[model samples]
Target chain A: MKGMTIIVKTITRWVKLFIFLFGIYVTLTGHLSPGGGFAGGVILACSFILLTLAYGKEYALSRLSLKTAKSLDSIGALIFLLTALIGMWVTNVFFDNVLQKLFPGTDFMLYSSGFIPLYNIGICLKVGAPLFVTFIVMAAMRIRINDKGEREIIQEEEEE
Target chain B: MFITEIYLLVLLVFMIIAAIIAVEIKSLISSVISLGAVGVGMSISFLFLAAPDLAIVQIAVEVLLLIFLIRATLGREIVSEKGAVTIPLRLLSIFIVLVILGFGIIAFRNLPEFGKPVFSLVPEAPSNSYIQHGLKETGSANIITAVILDYRGYDTLGEATVLFTSLLGALVILRAKTKKNGTKVINHKETKARGGE
Candidate 1:
């Protein structure tokens, strides 16, 4: 696919960075704000989706390849699991806030929440990468109508 | 009636109209757009209901859904077939919907009014303690975040696992299984060659 017109491309180039930053901000500040990991992850995915919509699938895939996305997805889940296991090892309780015991930071600060922000980051990666992959996979199967009015399938080149 | 209530009512009416339009529209693109309108209206309603987190998620997910639906429907010819539902079936479905709506309204009437906590404030409730001690325990200013990530961390972990599993399942189903000899099992090249002309 060639992608949309120049207007969309230009606007996407300008706006996509801010959207990515906002997603990061949301993930980082999940403990202090309304949006947590899930929401932030979705927003991050949207930025990539926006890029795909504007610059075509090839460019988007170049930015974040299937191999990298799959790895990030697994790494995210692993991180979350490791954090929980570490908490259990430290405090003998699953998912306990072990950092809270050591530091016990004050409320409303950026780093006050023990492991919540870490969880947020993990969930964000877990969600964002898979969602982008899903979109890419779904978008690969292209169906178009020919002049004879017959439904035809245009298959994307398979990635190795 | 409060101004917010009026806004909510208006949004609800708009959502209903959009939903009906989505159902009745013949064009797939138009139907998907109308459905997206309904979703946007719903997210707005969530904001009016003071759930910013839900509103954010709803709007983002709605946008993604719209994109996927539109992509699927774009350039596809709708093979017009006979209506699956007869008049009697339509009437029966309408009657069932009305009954459900009536029961829902009755239940709503029995429940506590807006902006009032009924059962959540009870001493035995987990949310009650979370609300009371969330900041002190988790040191997170946002109680919802604290409750979700700290108090209910196990649930969050389970939810993450569920997402991972679903993603894995989708990938597994969609992926083409290839033979070891580098020959394609799901032959897309043949379809592409046929469609190329």
Candidate 2:
């Protein structure tokens, strides 16, 4: 039984790693491909779900706490909004690409597109964190009724 | 006019069916699913009307809203018994559907040609050329990104603000308030009874 548990844990770890990497790939290639922040975020959230399923909620929460995830989500959202507001400062319109003055040339370079990549990253973080939080919180809230008809909230005890 | 009329008719039919399903479904989950379907159908209609931006926004918003709704509704006891669909209810739904469909068809008649490129009143600067150049220059292949972040960055920012507002709303709604007041506040008598058992 112990050996089986170890094997299961190993497999779950690999699955979570694969999902996380796939999410990165999707977000990076978003500009050149069909996928974008929405798809990438969903993929990233799926990795957390995999971790939660394989190792249990406690294990998952240990790695990525709900509080930390919520903070990251808020920060990402703020970054995205700030990027747009900065555009107004530069060009009198919100989100106008005034950063082109900082970059010399334009034509298929990473820095050439101004703040688009940054925007993508912001959206990726924003979408990924909330999605993971939604799944984890809901799963953690599950109540199990035992054979004795006693209801038990199946989660770790709150830490001091 | 011809193709537009045909497509409009098809969309009208879809809208009617979606409404009926949404109204008649016994299960709350199924009704929510139908509501999502209705949103998707409307987004498609928006796309048909040459509002790609609106369509994309509509689809994204609908998807997020559906996720939130599903999470909110999970584990709740669904009222299993559905009362009979009465005559007045049926007639009222039908009447509402007809009125909306008629209004939609009338609106469709006033729309511009589906394929015609309407000119913007703004200065005809090098927006198109800049977009073309962006494809080769930005190392990004997405035309939408080129237009959104490069040519029209301000609009993208507004879109981001909309997303931020939604995230804030979700946080407010889902935030855990007080800590679990010590695990169901066990009653002493009940605890003793259980101990005796």
Candidate 3:
């Protein structure tokens, strides 16, 4: 698919950065605000999705390739696991708020929450990358049901 | 209190109308769009009910779901394989639905009053403790975040793992294929196996 019209492309170009920033804001201020990791991550994915819808699939892949997205997904999961493991090592209990024990940060501040923001960031990456990857994969696939009731899957040709 | 109830009534009515339209619409695309309207209505209702967190999640998820559904339906060759439903089958299904709805209404009546949780019956419930000490213990202003990431961290961890696994499964299942010698083969393995096909 060649994507939508020029008007959409122009609007998307203007709006994409703001959307990314908003997602980061939501994830970072999760402790002080309503939205958290999952919600913020979805917003982040939506930014890339807007880009894909406006500027075609090839442009999106060029910006964030499937391989890189897969790696980011793994890395995000690892970071979350590492945070939990570190907590266990520090407090002798799994998933404990070790930072709180070490140094209780002041309340309502951005950095105050003990490891919650870190978890949010990790989860943001974990959720965002996979969602974007899922969209890309789904968009690339062309599935049809033939008259004989057989399923046919066709992979879209890559732009040279 | 009276105004709030009126607002909620309006929102609920809107949602019900949208839901009916979603079900009865002949065009698949129109049906999907109406279903999205139902979701957005639900999100607005959540906002009115003092749950902005749920509202945000609902709207975001709704957008993604709408995109996916539209992608599946738009510009696609849709084949309706199933024949028209028999009268008896339709009547039986409608009866089953009515019975389920009746049971649901009964269950709803048995629920505790609004804003008073059944957990209140148990004074020593963990949710009670969470509310009492959530902010103080976790130093997070949002008690919900504190509970999810701190008090019940294991649950969040499990949820993340589940999401990770499911997405990974989807990617593996949808991995692209290439025709090699007039036979379809997964290109993923070949790329890694030969450093490039």
Worst 10 residues of 2 chain A by lDDT: A151-160
Question: Chain A TM-scores, all candidates?
Answer: 0.89, 0.79, 0.91
- Of the two candidates 2 and 3, the one with more favorable lDDT, higher being better, is 3
Tens-place lDDT per residue, model 2, B66-149, is 887776767665547779999999999999999999999999887767884343322464665665576655445777666655
Better candidate by TM-score, 1 or 3? 1
Q: Per-candidate TM vs. native? A: 0.66, 0.54, 0.65
Residues B1-197 of candidate 1 have per-residue lDDT tens digits of: 49999999999999999999999989988999999999999999999999898899999999999988987987566556786788999999999999999999999998887887885646696677787888888888989888888888888888888888988887775566533433333346676566743
lDDT of 3 at A159: 40
lDDT per residue (tens digit) for residues A15-45 in model 3:
9999999999999999999998889999999
The model with the greatest DockQ is 1
For candidate 1 chain A, which ten residues in a row score worst on lDDT? A149-158
TM-score for candidate 1, residues paired by index: 0.66
lDDT score for residue A130 of model 1: 89
Off by over 4 Å in 1: A142-155, A158-160, B1-106, B178-197
Error of 1 at A24 (Å): 0.2
- Tell me which residue pairs clash in candidate 1: none
Query: Which numbered prediction scores highest in TM-score against the true structure?
Result: 1
What lDDT score belongs to each candidate, Candidate 1 first? 0.86, 0.70, 0.84
In model 2, how well does chain A match by TM-score?
A: 0.79
